[model samples]
Target chain A: MFRERLAQDAARIQKQFDLVLGALSDVDVTQAMSYATQGGKRLRGFLVLESARMHQVDIDRAIWPATGIEALHAYSLVHDDLPCMDDDDLRRGRPTVHMKWDEGTAVLAGDALHTLAFELCTRPEVGTADIRADLALTLAQASGAQGMVLGQALDIAAETAASPLTLSEITRLQAGKTGALIEWSAGAGARLAQADPAPLRQYAQALGLAFQIADDILDVEGDAEKAGKRLQKDARAGKATFVSLLGLDAAKARASELVDEACAALTGYGASAETLKDAARFVISRDS
Target chain B: MFRERLAQDAARIQKQFDLVLGALSDVDVTQAMSYATQGGKRLRGFLVLESARMHQVDIDRAIWPATGIEALHAYSLVHDDLPCMDDDDLRRGRPTVHMKWDEGTAVLAGDALHTLAFELCTRPEVGTADIRADLALTLAQASGAQGMVLGQALDIAAETAASPLTLSEITRLQAGKTGALIEWSAGAGARLAQADPAPLRQYAQALGLAFQIADDILDVEGDAEKAGKRLQKDARAGKATFVSLLGLDAAKARASELVDEACAALTGYGASAETLKDAARFVISRDS
Candidate 1:
């Protein structure tokens, strides 16, 4: 049931992307923007819709932040795959934006997608103006220098440092890189409803950590074809990851524990939170 | 006197940059962000501050959007100067971000600054929540795929086209590339006050075109030391510019005429708009 809902939400958000990007001129950059935003897992968007459903926020209103987070995520990936960054040629089973169009298009497309995230959050249908402002402000905070970019910068610096990062250092990096957006997505429902987000925040904190651990484990064990991109790059780079730091068995054990804590964080929501609990479980178990 | 006010506003906005970026952790990305944002004309920011003053918006409130536009402009320049783009090595008489650091740092810094622009627009002191939301929304429109990015994409396409861009084509490109943000900056005060933005919008339209024409003239004739960048690259590349499309004398005359139109648009504000008229005149007269 949770998987079905996740798939449904992903399709809906895909339509949202069409609506927004279609309104732009038919320039190559816009076309590149469309291409880059396609084929994400859409887990973040799912978290948004499920949380909004938990709060009784209308789907029509929920879709804005749902699509916004996806766009933001897409923008990050496009730039991350740039020749100057991760230098990856493949993303989501296709050529990266730079490989397909060129770096200038890739950069501009990513930049446009970033702005579109704010645009979606500020839409009139999203909520009251206060809510819209809060959403955009928090989104910026989660994605900017102090958040995802900070994490990425640290990662790059780590690549050239004299020594590998410690476990704690890796944890701090992941918190900024991947954890911030996950927490924000989990809490968006409460933000939309103007409700206290402590429980969702707690839930997301565990979920995000578990998610990263799973990613580390997948890097070691998962199939690249199924994952739809290059795998084992972390090990190849000799970078420390959850699996490397804790050993594969210990990393798996830790991820399972984090999932339990995540499920516990949703106890206040009662049975209706079952889908989110399933999501936490799936985070650790998914082949991809 | 107008130049003095412009410089004063620039200094004030620079301080705002320090206050905001200083609060972030001293990461390399933040350092690169500070580097990218430093040393610009700050004309867009001045337009915001001056128009806000005309609308009785307090400096405390007005400074948010003022800094926001500059940050946006800075991000555009940083990305535009990338090795894959314009490949500029010097900006504002100093090494470009990529030259100072690496391409990864430069890309992350530019992305962070882009987000910072929205963050500034959504600040609590900016005004009522409605106004803040409107500012962010309009800013995304002006700077995103349909605006500045569109202009940039078109410019890149022109570089490889079989024929040089015609006069009408270059004009359309400039509208998105440079004119959109200028119009947004000028209209921001009216947006803050919930007043009609038509007059300021009119003023900005003429002023923005004149500003680009002046830039073309500078590219052809200005001293590199004063302009602080390369000159005649357009002619060397055989790219058609305002000066190349129109004779140099005709281009100068057209810029002067547009300055008159820009100044005329402020007649609704009467004597209180003298500084803005001076700014329009300075657009064509200054070397940079």
Candidate 2:
């Protein structure tokens, strides 16, 4: 029954996202926008919706925030693929926006997506100005150089250094680069649902760390066909990874332990949080 | 007396900008942020103070909004200097952020600056949340692709294309690329001053256009030494130019006419608008 409900919510939210993406299409910007938005796992959106459900918020009220998170996630991917950044030519079996058009267009498209996220969140009719402002601030903190931007900076810096990262360093990098946004997605949904901040933040922190470990493990062992992109690029890049440092099996075990902690963190929220609990399970269980 | 007041205002605002810029210094992101913010005319900052002066608003109340606009303006310049965009190697006699640091640093620095703008505007002590939100939306609209971003896209597209652009096309490009932020800076100050939207927007639009025309004229005739950067590069690149289309003298004359129209638009606001009127004259009269 929970699975069915999750599917229903996903479908409904995906349709709303389609409308959001469709409306963004302009003659000059449409192609880049389509490339950025299409074929993502929609993991961030799921986090927003599922977390909102945990607080008994209706999916309709959660959809805009969900879309906002997805837009930000997509934009990060777009910039991450730039020649000077991760330099990946392909994403999800398609040419990246930079590869399809030019780096300038990709950069601008990413920028537009970032602005669009804030714009969508601030839509006055959807939520109170305070809620919108809080969400905007939360997302900005997660996405800016102090968060994801700083992570990317560290990643780039790591490329030139010969020093091996300790576990703490690796976790710090992942927390900023990957975990920040994931945490923000959950936190934003909770904010939209008007949940208590203390427990919600605790839950998000654990889930975010678990999510990154899962991603690191997937990069090591996940199938290319299922993952829809090149696998093992992380190892190839000489970048620090949980699987590389902790060993694959240990990384998998750590992810499971983190997920358990994440589930435990949500206990006070009651049965409404079952989807988020399942999401934690899904984060570690997925091959992709 | 007016010149002294304007100078004092500029110094005071620059001090505040220095504080904001100084906060980023300890972080690795400082180089790019410094590169982007340290120099330039502070025209947007000027507009912010001048607009507030029209309503006899406290300079302290106006400082945050001015800083916000400057932040936005700095981010735009950083992104504009990226290789995929303007590819500018030098700005203000120094290498641009992208040229000085790597492109990734430049990108992150721009993103951080953009977010910082909102952060400054939304400081709880600065104003009410409603005012902060309004300022953020106004600045975002001006900076986003639909406004400045789209203008830049068109500017770039026109640069590489074989098609001849009409004066209307040039006007549209300038309005978006350069004019939108100018308009926002003016309007945001007016908003802070609690001026009615009608007269404020009218003055803003005209001033914005006049500002662009003056910039175009300066690019043609100004000395590189005085401008603090290379001149004639625009012509060398065969980029669209008002001087190229209208002849050097005609462009200069048109810029002066725009100043007149811009100042005339402020007539409804009374003698208190003298700073803004002087700003318009400065726009057309200055060598740079």
Highest lDDT model number: 1
Candidate 2, what DockQ? 0.49
Q: Give stretches of model 2 more than 4 Å off.
A: A1-25, A56-58, A193-195, B1-10, B56-58, B193-195
What CAPRI grade goes to candidate 2?
A: medium
What alpha-carbon RMSD in Å does predicted model 2 have with respect to the real structure? Answer: 2.3
Clashes per model (N, Cα, C within 3 A)? 0, 3
Clashing pairs in 1: none
**Per-candidate DockQ versus the true complex?**
0.91, 0.49
Tens-digit per-residue lDDT, B8-54, candidate 2:
76677778877777764245565577658776778788777777777
Model 1 chain B worst lDDT window (10 residues): B224-233
Report the lDDT tens digits of candidate 1 across residue range B127-147: 999999999999999999989
In angstroms, what RMSD does candidate 1 have relative to the true structure?
A: 0.9
- Worst 10-residue lDDT window for candidate 2 chain B reads B23-32
Model 1 CA deviation exceeding 4 Å by range: none
Fraction of native contacts (fnat) of each candidate: 0.93, 0.30
Question: What TM-score would each prediction reach against the true structure?
Answer: 0.99, 0.94
